[model samples]
Target: MQQLLAVAIRDILPNKVRLAITRLCFFFNAICSKVLDPVKFDDLENEAVIILCQLEMYFPPAFFDIMVHLIVHLVREIKCCGPVYLRWMYPVERYMKILKGYTKNLHRPEASIVERYIAEEAVEFCSEYIKKAKPVGLPESRHDDRVGGKGSRGLHVITPSVEDLLQAHLYVLNNSNEVLPYIVQHQHLVKQSNPKMSKNWVLKNHNKTFSDWFKDKIFADENVSETLRKLAHGPKRNVITWQGYDINKYSFYTKPMLTVNSKHIR
Candidate 1:
């Protein structure tokens, strides 16, 4: 259902309708994650309600009745006791199905369940007492032939290719523009150490060489000024709070502004 809604909003639906509905669903999912504080929850609830009402006004009444009721109640429930998962019946429903599967005799299901459960528990307890004993229902030899050797674990480790290493190094350099001068100095030092070293070799080992040189610079306190420059520059805010109003020319106008603090903006 979540994936369907996401696909509809992101790909299928038009932007005018999709933007509003997507924002509402995004907040709903965020609330479900149970990470939001009271202030943030309140903000989300307000935005959700506004968006829901706008959607109801634009769409047919029949389309919203049940959904609106559920959304309102969900918001209220979240406000009262955090996320929905805390009070949801999904885990209980799963366990109930498991218990139902254990029944043998439909007429005397309770008795059958109790007997089977007790016998299973006893067998499990006894199995634990035996050294290197496998579980009761499992096969005696459970070796996974797909993994090749008997002792080999079925784990695939990924190693980055030379091109991947080069790309990663370039990405770091591009983002951290301040590191260029230091890299140039390091290259000069490398050239002095190995006069015959080719530019191709330096390019290939750029990431490793830069990392080693950077570490040395830190330990020797050579780039204290550069470090301080980096420390002084704070992280940029990615979020913008917008206030919408009706204009004469434009039906709706939204003015974007930065929030006072990160806590107030999602």
Candidate 2:
């Protein structure tokens, strides 16, 4: 069963980073399930293996939860785009909420450890990751009461403290990264094309305030109510990445995003 699972994983994982994550997940699950039959999931390079092992020690099951949270978004999209019956087979939204709450709580301790590691090591891994990452445009910018001006294209840098970073990750688990992939990977087409309006689109669309949107659209689930409350009351500009793979926003400096130059990136 484990061998078959490994084979399937190799087929699905599209890159080195995803492969590293797969191997780490495989290791964690194998250790927990006591699968000791000489599995060959350790085909990762030396550096990748070391990083995965470090992540395992630094995060344990918490890292797995974070990875699961990111993957859930993709899985949800797949279901949404599939047949109606297939959509019912996966409780994507409800599972996402559960994973969000779980991942947020998991990182509480790790953020503290990350904070300490960054301070002691004097490495700005978080900043480095952010610098390397191509910025994504905000989706459907609306006028902000706080700024009292029309929003323009720019990076939304939300700086958070160590504890706040942990909380942010939890909050973001529910908010999928719809803009990043579109903007970063396919910039020309998006810029040239005027996107067709959806059949369900509305101009004034019974406009809901932030609180209104939170209550009606977002906050029906009671499982994450406490966390949501914290988020509602807390700051948003800079926080830890709970759900998304964008590591730049995370509080830790040691676990930066692995970047290669566009020329070198394969």
Number of clashes found in candidate 1? 0
Please, what are the lDDT tens digits per residue for candidate 1 over residues 141-206?
Answer: 434233332222222334556656545655665466576777788777777777788987766566
Considering summed lDDT, which 10 consecutive residues are worst modelled in model 1?
A: 148-157
TM-score of each: 0.46, 0.15
| Candidate 1 structure lDDT | 0.63
- lDDT of every model, 2 decimals: 0.63, 0.43
Clashes of each: 0, 5
TM-score for model 1? 0.46
User: What local lDDT does model 1 show for residue 100?
Assistant: 82
lDDT of 2 by residue, 1-266 (tens): 43456566676655665556566565445433433332333332233446456555545585566654443243234333632233353578786554454343454856755565556456576667676565589453233223332223232454757555444543453353432332233333333342564423322221112233444433565665465555444355553322222222222222334584321211
